[model samples]
Target: RKQLVYSSCRAESAGKALADVMPDETVHNILLTASLCMGFSAFSYEFMPTGDARRFNYIAMAMTGFCTIGYVSMYNGVGVIEVRGHDVFWMRYLDWAVSTETFLLGLAMLSGADRWDTIFILAMDAIGVLCALVGALIPAVVAPAYLLGAVVFAAYNYRLFGTMQVSADRMGAAVSAKYKRLTTQSMAAWCVYPVVYLFCEMTRALDETTEVALYACCDVIAKCVCCFLLLSQP
Candidate 1:
């Protein structure tokens, strides 16, 4: 009876936590489910940071940090309530490592190590964790599509980085133009991904019945835009 009661209480608490974060009662399920999907989508790209040019490198790092923090907060509050003592220690370490890695990656970039560094690995790990949590929580409705996008995005970043690295050898205005275009396009491309994420959350909060559809549409649109932005550079 005591165990049953404890489980019931935990369930109640979890529901409350979910309610608190959700923007509206009507679309609570959608928001919760969407966040879970997004989280899982994010986890898959956590480890492909290799070969990113400076701009892409920085964006990858930022994405990882955002996804990690978002997942930790969402998971701890809404998904896992009865975490065991041993797991608690690991969770603490996970949190610390993610936070520390994010911080270090930022500091390294700002201090000018963006060209080459191992911070990429740390950022990727954080992203992986975020994706895993999403996989664990969200309904698998649109997960496969999201995962495809992530894989494509990672590959795009890799190829872009390779092109930039080779372009460094060019002389005169070509070099400058390549760098300028890359910087501008990458900045523009990355900004859209986060905006799409925020839009999905906001749409859920607004209690829209089309929240999932809208998010999927927006995500596809955003990916297209990012691709265009990247292409515009070369």
Candidate 2:
């Protein structure tokens, strides 16, 4: 259903064009990542009132907490390796920063998420469409910066799933493999924002938001309808 909307709206075509032009698979990954991430986000906001920045933040923190626990447990089982005192402090600081950032982003989204603006919302939707188009049309050289931006900005998602492991206590090997797959997939999701942002910037670079806007409007209607249903629900 999501892919249908993406395709019917012509985003897939754009992506194909971008993919054709760029030889790198990273471009395609970034393109798909952006579409999936932003599409999920737009869908959630549109259809599920409970889905918002707050939910995103909560999920982020939960993942991070689990990863931290997993890391600690694994270290204990392995017998602690001694680190210089300064290194310990640095690692502790990094952990603190990751946890705090997760909490804060959630808090920020929850406490003061702006009223859903149609233009901005549509603009967000446009991001994926543009990425698809650019990736297909432009040189691969354009991908790295967007990749970097995604890494810098959405880096928190990485820590959230970083330390997850399959435990022998309960799940079978199949379950463990599935969990590992999920963790890796989650890590991939962390890059979606950079792809979307980069794609939008690329289109904006070409002064082509006008065409992108058309594709974006299809998503806009879907989102607005979702928002309406959410409002109508008791």
Candidate 3:
């Protein structure tokens, strides 16, 4: 009887924790609004001409589509999971895993990077994102996982600045200029993600609502605004 009562109490405590951490109605409304914008962005790509640029348009569409789905899931309380008394939005990581790859694909395509270089960059990106997800889910290994993610991100930057830049430069001054601008914008947006994760997940410096809002801003810039910039280039 004592053991049963203890288990029941723990379960109740967990239930309460989940309830407390879940985004309030305001946050849900924000997510819904973001989802609608992303959905519209994804739909707009359908009219893009089918030619050499079609792949880029499709990649942009996929990135926004994934984000739309992720935001909708979060709004519905579908992908929020409790981890060590905190709520982890696993769908955000899922969104990053696929959407960020599409983002990188656009970069690689724009830079005219060789097959091997493209593969290397994409693989490193995946590793970094996976490390971040693992760190968010498991409290004990948070530091090590974050460090690993950072290291992989550094390798990704090396390729972006060195190999990919070289490829873009060979294309011409115009392409190189465009690639540099877009890459700079992408790096600026991406650098915030780990910092936000560290504060919101590791140190608990920011509350859940702030974390979600910050991430939403980053997502809009990285996926939607960046895609529009890329597609606008001649």
**Between candidates 1 and 3, which one is better according to TM-score?**
3
Ranking by lDDT: 3, 1, 2
- Of the two candidates 1 and 2, the one with more favorable lDDT, higher being better, is 1
Residue-level error in angstroms, candidate 3, position 192 = 1.0
Lowest-lDDT window of 10 residues in candidate 2? Answer: 80-89
Best by TM-score: 3
By TM-score, highest first, what's the ranking?
A: 3, 1, 2
- Please give, for residues 1-234, the per-residue lDDT of candidate 3 as tens digits: 999999999999989866765678878878888898899989987776646668888888999999999999888787898887677999899999999998898899989999999999899999998998888898888899999999999898899989899999999998899999999888888998889988998888998778888888888888888888778766
Q: What is the lDDT of candidate 1?
A: 0.41
Whole-model Cα lDDT of every candidate shown, in order: 0.41, 0.35, 0.88
Report the C-alpha lDDT of model 1 over 16-57, residue by residue, as the tens digit. Answer: 876654333433454355445444444543443434444544
For model 2, the superposed segments whose C-alpha errors exceed 4 Å read 1-154, 166-172, 189-192, 206-234
Best by lDDT: 3
State in Å the error of residue 206, model 2: 4.6
Backbone clashes in candidate 3 total 0
Model 3 ranges off by over 4 Å: 1-22, 48-51
Model 3 global lDDT (CA atoms, 0 to 1) = 0.88
- In model 1, the worst 10-residue window by lDDT is 81-90
